[model samples]
Target: MTRVLRAGVAGAGVFGGYHANKYKQASDIDFVGIYDLDIERAQTAATAHGVAAFDDLDAFLSSIDVLTIATPAFAHAAVALAALEKGIHVYTEKPLAVTSRDGEAMVAMAAEKGLVLACGHQERAVFEAMGLYDVPEKPLRLEAVRNGTASTRNLDVSVVLDLMIHDLDLAISLAGCEAGGLQATGRRREDEGYSAVGGDEVNAEVDFENGMKAVFRASRMAAERERTMRIVYPSGTVFIDLLNRKFENGTPFALNSDFAEADIARDPLGTSVFRFLDTVLGVRDRPLCTGAEALQALELGFAIDEDVAF
Candidate 1:
């Protein structure tokens, strides 16, 4: 019989609640508790889920065999490092960390400890649903646009990390190569008292080592929400309406026409969490997104922010 793992979420925010729900629903996971610096917030979430709440970080870490870090972007590394040191598997939400250094440290520690470290790049499931990874031909050029209406969430990081990082990961995964060069420009909305501190809009072009040119545009100050991608391959082009879960595939390869109905694509967050648990249980080789993969995405996000000309 497979051993049941004690799983906990290290946050009480919206994403944290989502992770907690996954844990609660997992058959092989013993949904442990919720941890947060804000004790009241933790209590509220834990109570809602009928689990314990922990204000002390160490106490929280001690009780769980696996941890899902839904903490703020800046706190991800610290929380993950602490959990890894205690021999706990960790699954961190996207962008891995605010900086490449912190992401590297978390990945290195997970490798050293022989523990699973997953990232919440749930969008990967969408590609899997569409069977994009099975295509042999690499993309010649890729374009992604992700925009969001004004919101107070994820203000601690720039739009590059908050929104663009998803496309960056997809672009990198599809390219399957290192980035050779990048150029970027962005504008912040702080002057307008929008509350977000860093870049509110970013446009970046990346040249991958495999000769793929990827363009990314992300905005947190958009009038409407939009998520779309266009992939140009040697054979033809594939356009995706990510927000609406529809696509127009022009490639010769057989892509799933009903990908939207697939469970993996429909509920990526649940699939990601379950995959992490399965990896921890030795039922799978890896999660939907591993630490190294997330680190690569994070490093690219850092590059875009640093190379911003305005």
Candidate 2:
């Protein structure tokens, strides 16, 4: 029997708890323990998963073959680099690092150590289900919107990083072109309690060298949550309703056709963890989102932030 890989979680917040549960449920992994700056949160998550909780980062790092960093985006580089330097495989949540410099450094470290570094851009699975992974021909235009009511989580960053990055990552993956240029505008709401970071809404347009254009919008203070992406190619268009988990395809832009269910509902984080284990066992070729792919997403995010002024 193959030995189950031991995994440790480095945060106990919402995403951290989710990672811990995924590790516990994955057959190929042994959920070793959890760690957090907040001891109580770590203990709570560890107990819920029936694993040990360690407040010491070094002790936790020493116990697992893999580390899942689910902390805030600003802290991703510091924590992940520490683990990578220790020769532990790392799976970090999206917006890999706050800046391109940090992201490049982290990627370099992982490559130097020959360790697997995966990002939490699980939306790629949705693209795979939509058959967009094959990289369609040069897209004439792309429209995307991801909005949600203010959630207390992950508000330390602007909506561009907090939410729009998902669509940006997806757009970059599907367009199969480097983010050569972009222009953006955004607004910040100071009275909304978390506006100190930036505005509550961001709208931007990205132009690829291949003549593809992508328009994206993200808002954290919307009346209702919406996640949708529409891609228009020369031949047909593909529409994804992320909120409802529905996919639609139209050639000649037809209407009234019953769209087929994609059934791509497996938990993405869980799927990510399993894929990481497959990498460890030499059963998979590469991680779903490699360090380079994540760096591209992060670079696009920074460009959007820089282009847009509140």
Candidate 3:
């Protein structure tokens, strides 16, 4: 009989809370326990989800079949490395790690341990509209803008890691090429009052080995939120408005329409989490975003950071 997977969530923060709730509600798995440095927060989350709360990391680590690390970006490497070393499967929040080196190490360790490592880039699961279709043939030029009102979460990382990485992942998935070169420029927010700890808004252009070009813009200090992408291919153009959950395809289908009121059958986030669980149960060979694929996105983001003129 297939054993029920016991999943433990580390970190009782926003994303961690979401994972805990999903595990609790999922029928295929057991919500083993939740752990956090802050015992009160962990207890609160566990009680809300009807799961156990642990203050000790060692005990928590020894008890679960899988570990979901939703900690801050800077702590991802350390927590993931520890879990992988212990032969535990991992599902972590996006921007896998702060640096390419850490990201590579995490992937290597998971492979060495014969365990699955999934990154939470949930947007990839959005099936609303034609979001799943790949960019036809070669995308000569691509433009993506992901901006959001200031949020205190992930302030430790620049907007490139926090926001732009999403579009970078999508661009890499569509371009299907390793980044050949990248150039970027960024500026810190002028109004200190907007954020006590200022962060940079970055614009980057990346050249891919397959002769594709991509332009990306991301800002955490925007007055309003927007997530949009435009891909221009040889045949036609495709645009996705992630914020509005709408898409326009001008290629094979000459449809100039919107899906703002479309009845999405399932929640994309739920789909992503269930897919990860499917991977854990050996129902899927690999996740939609593999560890290596996520590493590539992180590497591209890091390259842009390095090339940024400051």
Candidate 4:
């Protein structure tokens, strides 16, 4: 029988709870419990999942072979570093860290320890299902829009980190090269109650080293949820409606509709979790989303947030 790896969560809140449930459903892993600053919430979440809650961070870290850090973006680096130092495989939610420096540290430690480190950039799975990765020609231009109604979730950072980062990751992946630089403008927040130091609505134009260009617009104060992308190549264009979970290939390449229901349904978190576990267990050749990749995306996002002046 394949050994079931012990898995635990670092936060008992929104994404943490979601991840806990995923761990329960995944057959190769045992849902151990959660560790959080709020002991009560952790205990409650643990009870709901039929697992033990930990008030003691060390105890929680010691008990699990894999720790998924679904804490706030700012806290990711610290929690990831602790778990990585303890030789535990780590997977963190997106926008790896508030700062590129912290993100780089997490990636470095994972490499040093030879432990699997993955990021929760789930949208890549959507593209994978669309066979977007197999598009023959490099994109000359790309456009992305990711908007969602105001929510109290992930308010620790601006809309760029919370919402736009997803599209930014995708743009970079499709561009398939390092970014040269970018130009951006953003609003702090129209919703007074949800504003942060990091702003909420942002639009950026990125120039890639390989001559591909991308324009990304993300807003958390949107009236309706939207997630869409368009990639332009010499031959034709590819348009993907992420929210609708389908794509239209204006190009000649025969893109497959052979994707599974879950993939097409846009619940890539399950796929992301599966990939993370596979990487940790050495069953997968490589991570679908790596710490370093997330770090690069974070760096670009910060640049957009801070470098508005050309």
Candidate 5:
């Protein structure tokens, strides 16, 4: 018989709630509890799932075999390190950590402990559903746009890390190589009293070592939400409308025309969380997004933000 693992989530925010729900629904997970610095907030989220809430960090870490760090972007590394030190498998949300140093530390500790370190770049599952990774030819050029109306959430990080990092992960994964260089332009909303670091909106172009190029635009001050991408391959082009869950594939590869109907695409967060669980259970080799891949995305995000001309 397979053993069930105790799973817990660190954080009581929106994304943390999502992870808690996934854990509650997983057959392999015991769906342990929640931990948050704010006890009341943790209680509120845990009550919804009929689980325990922990205000004490050490107690929370001691109870779980696996942890999902869905805390704010700034706290990712610290929380992950705490869990990793306990010999717990960790799955952290995207941009892994604000600093490459922190991301590297998390990855290193996970490796040293022989624990699985996964990132919540769930879009990789969507791309798998769309058969993007199965294409034979590498993309020559790609374009991506991700915009959202102003919100207080994720204000601790710049738009680059909050929004653009998703596209960066996709771009690097599709290119299957390290970025050679990048250039970017951006604007700060300081006058408007928004506290995003680096910038609030940015447009960047990344050149990969394999001669591939990807252009990305991200804004947290947009009038409406939009997410789309276009990939130009040597043979053809494929345009994806992420928000609408549709695509126009002109590539010769037999991409999944009904990807929106696929289970992974319909609920990528579920797929990602389950993948982490399966990896921890030794049923899968890796999660949809690995620590190294997320670190690459984080490095590129910081690079793009650093090169931004605000």
Candidate 6:
């Protein structure tokens, strides 16, 4: 039997708690506990899950060999570095870090320590399960839209980091190549004040070395929710309405035709967690999302933010 791993989660917010629940339900995990700036919140989650609650970050770091960081974007690098320095495996939520330099540093630290450093680009799992990578040919163009109603939740970073990073990571995964050059433009929501901290809408066009191109649109100001992607290949088109949980695999080279109605919920986060465990347990050689890949996405996101007209 595989040995159980002791695990801890930093941050007690929605995503942190969600990660905690995943650890609790996994048979290979001995869920150690949680930590948060608000000790009360940590205790509440700890009590509910029957795990230890730590008020001190160092103590929490000492308690577990594996950690999931669901903290804010700006704090991801610091926490991940600390965990890696302590020889702890880390699975952090997306954007890796607010700056590319920090993302690079985190990646370097993990490499130095030989720790499993994974990022929560969970959306990649669903796309992979759907076989988005097996297109009949290299995509001439790829398009994506991920928009939703405004929320105060993740305003610490731009929409490019808060929301667009998902699609950007997916864009890289589907293209299966490094992006070359990109041009971008954006504006904040009209209703917000002039000093608003982050953008509400953003757009970018990325060029691949092989002459393939991809365009992305992300907005947090939409009245409705939508998450979709359209990949154009020589054979045909693959259209995915991620919000509606449906996709039309229009290629003549059919893969999974009934994917939309396939009863299984598209729970990529679960898949991401399992992949992290697999890496830590030595069952897999690499995580689903590596630090280098997350860093690449962060670098591209910063490039996309450069032309923001707002």
List CA RMSD, all candidates: 1.0, 2.6, 2.5, 1.9, 1.0, 1.8
Supply the TM-score for candidate 4. 0.95
State TM-scores per candidate. Answer: 0.98, 0.93, 0.92, 0.95, 0.98, 0.95
How well is each residue in 1-310 modelled by candidate 3, as lDDT tens digits? 8769989998898888888877877776888888888899999988888889988888898898888888888888888898899889998888899878899999999999899998987666663234444333778888999998867778877788889999888888877779898878887776656553224688999999999999999998789999999888888887878787777777775442444433332465565677778888889877767788899998888888777744
The sequence of per-residue lDDT tens digits that candidate 2 reaches over residues 42-143 is: 899889889998888899998988989998888899989989999999999988998899999999999999999999888776667556665446678899
Which structure is stronger by TM-score: 3 or 5? 5
- The lowest-lDDT stretch of 10 consecutive residues in candidate 3 is 256-265
Comparing 4 and 6 by lDDT, which wins? 4
lDDT of 5: 0.92
Off by over 4 Å in 1: 190-192
After superposition, which runs of candidate 4 have C-alpha atoms over 4 Å from their true positions? 190-194, 258-266
Q: Report the candidate with higher lDDT, 2 versus 3.
A: 2
Number of colliding residue pairs in each model: 0, 2, 0, 0, 0, 0
User: In candidate 5, how many Å is residue 58 off?
Assistant: 0.5
* lDDT score, candidate 6, position 98: 88
Error of 5 at 265 (Å): 0.7
What's the lDDT for candidate 1?
0.93
Tell me the deviation in Å of residue 184 in model 3: 0.8
Pairs that collide, model 2:
187-199, 188-199
Q: Write the residue-wise lDDT of candidate 1 on 129-178 in tens digits.
A: 99999999999999999999888899999999999999999998999989
- Report lDDT (CA) for all predictions: 0.93, 0.83, 0.81, 0.85, 0.92, 0.84
